[model samples]
Target: MAHMSILLLVISSLLLASTNAHDFIKYGYNGANGADKWGSLSSDFSLCSQGKQQSPININKNTTNYDSNLKQAPRNYVLTKATLINNGINIVLKYDQGAGNLTLDGKIYALTQMIWHSPSEHTIDGQSFPVELQLIHRSSDNHIAVVAILYQYGSPDAFLLQIQDELEQLAKDKCTDEQEARVPVGVVQTRALERRTRKFFRYVGSLTAPPCTEDVAWIILGKVREMTKAQAASLKAPLSAEYQSNARPAQPINGRTVQLYDELHNVKKAPSSKSD
Candidate 1:
């Protein structure tokens, strides 16, 4: 536990050493994370485009009555056991050890790196949450299962409060003009990523962004974590100029089923804009 100022300074310093925030953190499709380069980075990341998956699905969790028999498998990732490594772009994650496998519907998907997006890239129950962290895990058979969680404005969630403090301390530059920063080694944990309950919405979909790759196991939860407005603002803050809207438009479901554990919950489409 360190002071806020100290953490921010550290992040600034690390990022400044080589790249700047604009390089990866900011929006626009020229540099790393810039949607334009997603295709060239890695073949797997190619799904960033060429996908026909539904974008944001707002969760207005009303029922916990549904029961899901989530087959237990060796966790592909140990949330707390991550080693932070920034590869040119924003920050690239590398696991300290091999993630065995994650079980869902009796299928196992090997653990892959979990990354963060700004201001959230999706919505829930038509109620747009502030942020969304997509945990991408792949199975040995090349199958994929994504556990998606939306951050909202309500009672603060323990994980969000913790991660906020950790990110704020990312290596900050000594000078204001400088860019790029470093986040402490031990920042997030896999344990925290697990939903309070195994109950979730399962659907056959594609990546929300480009490449529009289809056939991804999308597991979205009705649980929305509480985060402060400041925290929400911070996510979108970095990409203000180039990508005030880091989120993409919700793709067409095209007759896809947004289902809950056993029974399916039909989530209707959300209007482009809605008032709270």
Candidate 2:
């Protein structure tokens, strides 16, 4: 019965990927056909066995711009190394990291690689946000912790633009960049510029990838970033049909509670491929 239910969910996700935007099929999970085999391949994988399924939410809560006056960085974030994957659909740049004294409300956490998801995941009340930056971090005892930032469509961010410009020299795929002299959107388009309003909703969740590991501390940011329509379009500009949309659907939450942090009623707002 569980296998049948999971298969049904897979079919539903396939249908969801059939959005009018584009047709692109995702890789992995059932990449090799057997959905229940990732656990035996590795031991540090429990989300595969215990993960609760959930669909991406529509955040429709506080649209009112509030004073995001929260101050202070974690005082322990260090970017060690960066790994880039330009697969034509979306550029995925990961940073190998270190946390000197990483702490959230005083709890220790270490920096990990970051990933991007279009049309941001966790929603507020019911409205879906546009972009999300998943910063994977770990704690003192070695547990998964993710910081999810939801972005609204607005003006382009300068910090992101800087990173975008830097990636021009490191692109692996020529088809992804139009001019061949500029960086791809994956590096420049998804990022949070707001130093304050770092407050976020906390909960337990799984990785939105194959094996669906559930060992994670999920942090959904109530504050959102801004990017212009033109900037957003540029992200898709370099994307080829292969990398047009590479997002995974949100996993099921079962009957879990979606907790919020420093609730400010703050809210805002990914894709895959066709089975070809």
Candidate 3:
């Protein structure tokens, strides 16, 4: 049954991405043109407004139960030549080959690109984080698995500082084009899947963006990474002023259950504002 679920998910993702690629319009997160109006923007984005299993949900610890079937996806990231794009909304990191790959339940998904969302899209127990870094993966068949790491204001994260400096440079000229950069090997993957406890929440949800395709496996790491307030400001500096909150609001979970996988059995019952 576990294998079946993964297979079906992969197939669903492939079909959705292919069918919705052309019509996958870009929508913002504000009134009229924001998330509330995504579905009406185009017939293709009907899922955004209509899907019952949308992402960026508010996760409460009490709402989840342990699932023995869930397994940790191994991270094998290699140094890669990457590019940074402002894209008006958020800063996106695009990498050439040699980034990394995730092996989940025997299925391999290649790390394609990553991006940051300010003020976080997903929250823990209705509490927001400083930022959320999303590492996007695509299987050989194009199944999408998003690994999100929540960030809080605190001691600076070395990897984040590296990217932050590059983003700050981009902000100087307000460059939105894909500028050359190098992502050190394992820098992007190390802290994401490797937490102090290595736990995560898994769910079947749609993309937070347009077309809002469903059946995309969302693997949200329980660990909350930290960066200084200055680092947070540097990240937001590249984004446009209007893109203040690039995060999407928490959507309804509908009837779906969020499964938790605690490999180390050390997840705290009470969520802390910052990660250990």
Candidate with maximal TM-score: 3
Candidate 2's clash total is 28
- Stretches of candidate 3 above 4 Å error? 1-26, 175-197, 266-276
lDDT of each: 0.52, 0.50, 0.75
Point out the worst 10-residue segment of candidate 2 by lDDT.
267-276
| Residue range 172-210, candidate 3, lDDT tens digits | 745433432232322343343334335788888877787
State in Å the error of residue 152, model 1.
Answer: 0.9
- Highest lDDT scorer: 3
Ranking by lDDT: 3, 1, 2
- The residue-by-residue lDDT of candidate 2 on 31-67, one tens digit each, is 4422344444433334445656423433333432233
- For all predictions, the C-alpha RMSD in Å is 11.7, 12.8, 8.4
Per-prediction backbone clash count: 48, 28, 2
